[model samples]
Target: MSLVSKFATVGGATLISRIFGFGREMLMASALGVGPVADAFNLAFRFPNLFRRLFAEGAFNAAFIPLFARALEEDGEEGAKRFASEIFSTLFSVLVVLTALAMIFMPALVTTIIAPGLAVCVDDPAAGGNALSCAMRFEITVTFSRIMFPYLACMSLMAMVCGILNAYRRFFAAAAAPTLLNFILIGVISYALWIEADKATIGFLMSWGVLVAGIAQLAMVTLAMRLAGFSVALKRPRWTKGLKRLLVLAGPAALIGGITQINLFVGQAIASFKPGAVSILQYADRPYQLPLGMVGVAIGVVLLPELARSLKAGRLAEAQHTQNRSLEFALFLTVPAAVALFIIPEPIIRVIYERGAFDPSATPAVAAVLGIYALGLPAFVMMKVFSPGYFAREDTKSPMIVTLVSAGINIVLSLVLFPILAEQGIAWATTLSGWLNAVLLFLGLWRKGLWEIDGKLVKRSLLVLVSALLMGGALIAMMWELNAWLQPGDAVTTQIAAIAILVAVAMAIYFALTLLTGAADRTMVMRLVKRKRG
Candidate 1:
């Protein structure tokens, strides 16, 4: 299969997952709205989800895949299996202890780490009689956090297995496994809505659904590994050189891998001071995540293994070309997506989330946050593209330092802005910090002579920006034309149809302009589609 073809396999599955996630979020918005229950649920889920991102996406992808590829290359199948078994046993033991401790100290974790602002709610003069309500929300958050903490263990194990699959170029099952979480949650939320469950009941059911989904996701990927003729047997945990090396690499890569999540974690911590802020930021996050997951994630997953294998084989030129093409592909899709989201976030948010208990009054706030996030969309994707250059070479420390600096900037900016702009300030802080991370990663690669901007890549990038801007202009015009049908009080079908027309028009204009201007061409695209893996 071509490299792009491999990317397509993962991207297609992620696209499916994102679509299901949209459904889940839509239902969640209707059921919980931007109320206290919604805040409790989102805050609770973020705690485990943060760790899931760190372990599953960050640590494993950054540290595990390249080593697994090395095991396959040097020690053959038997050695790789032994390595996997050893790592599996050790990881399982650690997760068991971690999950137990986290659950036992759930209340402290909730009040101190997850959201310290919630702890002071009862003491606030502004809270008054609402003090009791705040206390209840605090307890609900703690309960939900405990219920879902075990999910971190399931996801961490699943990530290790998925890393093995990626090393073997088996990407579909791992890419598709996330859809199961959305599927299960969608069903749970649907059932709640059908039976008219109250907010607290809905929150509890959804938290349990997360744990169940994590288990199912692990089983699916594990089954895929077995079907692919690979198995890691349970064994006594042993401290081996390989395990020691993985920890050494993973310690730094974890931060590099989870920089985006870390920034969001910080934002969530601060946003918790105001009711509905956490849920508002989350609602805004879903729309942009579609493109990020489909394009950025697919590139990160596919590019890392490919680059590692190329570098391992001493194909220096091939590795450089892979980096260039990955960046090109990432920008080609995400630039236009960012443009669309920035231009029409209000209409998009309204169509997806404006019904039920989600008040029309909340639309502008969410839209503002979404627009700011859209501005950072390409930066986020670029970080995904550039970080692999370091990781493929087993140089996690450089990116780790860059991530820490960016994170500090995010923290400083969030504190400076949140008091002034509310949630939008958090959005601004995240966006600015993202661009800094992307820039530093790119410069690190270039300074080391690991990557260079070829003329084709440079030319196409500029043209892609132009094409996206042209599409954004057209979208503004169309929005003005369709204003009557896109209103909040308009019929749901009418609003959806209007948004659909806008999206269809935007895609057509963007693709047409890219083709006309040679930002992308049929020959180049066909080569990407048809070229086999080197």
Candidate 2:
């Protein structure tokens, strides 16, 4: 499949998944506001998600795709299948053992990372309001972490299998697995909310839902693999040379790919000093992630295999062209998104949330963080697209070093900025660090002469930015009236109607401006559609 079509296939599925994720968080905000219970959920949830991103998405895919593609190239379809099956068996055994160990050592891990989750259980009566009174509270979340951490193992294994399928040029069902994960989480949370009347028990329900969803997600992907006639079966592990290379390459890629997550962890660590800070960051980051997940991640996920195949065929120029186009698209789409978030965060938050337990007071605080994060949205997405260039070459160490530098900046800034700027400061640090990562990668790629682009892509990108600026200006002006109409005294239905109208107006303006400015012309889009036979 062409990169554009593959991205569309994956991006469309990812959009649905992200929308569902938004709904899941909305339910969560209503159920668990920015408080101790919410903190616990974030802590327990981050536990697995942290590693899942590091392994499944980052390290595993980086190492797996190039090798898998090469296998398919040299050994034909059957040889590649066997290699995948063997890796699956080894990974499953290791993950099972690791998950078991995690169930036992949950307390120590929680204490080290998310000490704030234990607030309710700590000996100090007043500790529930403090993020750090976690001395004894870690024990409470251990059970939840135990249930949830296993989800990482399941997801990591699934990611490996998915990488195999993608290498074989199967994108639909595998990309759709996350949609299943989102659906399962939504269902579990909905059921939990339906049954639970007590506030405290809500956390338990959410945690349980997360555990069930992980299993469901694993099943969904495995079943898809089965139907594709490539289901991985259990086999014994051997110290194979190929596997060793993957391990060596992936170790640093995992860490490198995990820079954003690490930044998130640093935020969480700093957030440990203040109540509601973790939840605050989480809630604020939700809306912005929609575009990131839909666009940035979709491109990255699809790009790896495309680049892998190109590199396998020794089409360096073709790989460079694809990378540059992906970079341009990411920049064009995400820059506008960043501008919107930067310009009018309150209305966006208010429109989606700020109802039920999520009060008006929560709006400004969340919006502040949202604005800060949006600043680096384009760079963040571009980083996702560009990093795959190196990953496809099995040069993970370069990205790893870049990621380390970015991570260090985040850590230092989080500590320094947290007190001065409060929740948003850590967010700003993250934004700056993301751009720093992008800058380093861009320089690295250019220095290596890995990317050379034509003129049209650059023109389109500049046009996109100009259109985005105009759209942002329009939204900034329009939202003031929107906020007025959606004011507290207005009827709830009227507020909803006003929000709908504002959203319509903003989108129409952006699209119209995009057309006029030649940001997304029909001709360019059509060219993207016409598959360039590699």
Clashes of each: 0, 1
TM-score of each: 0.98, 0.93
Q: Compared with the true structure, what per-residue lDDT tens digits does model 1 show for residues 147-249?
A: 9999999999999999999999999999999999999999999999999999999999999999999999999999999999999988889999999989988
TM-score of 1: 0.98
Q: Residue pairs in steric clash, candidate 2?
A: 118-137
The top-ranked prediction according to lDDT is: 1
Candidate 1 lDDT score at position 13: 99
lDDT tens digits by residue: candidate 2, 199-243: 457777777777777777778777777787776667888778777
Residue-pair clash count for candidate 1: 0
**Error of model 2, residue 64, in angstroms:** 0.5
The deviation in Å at residue 320 for candidate 2 is 1.9
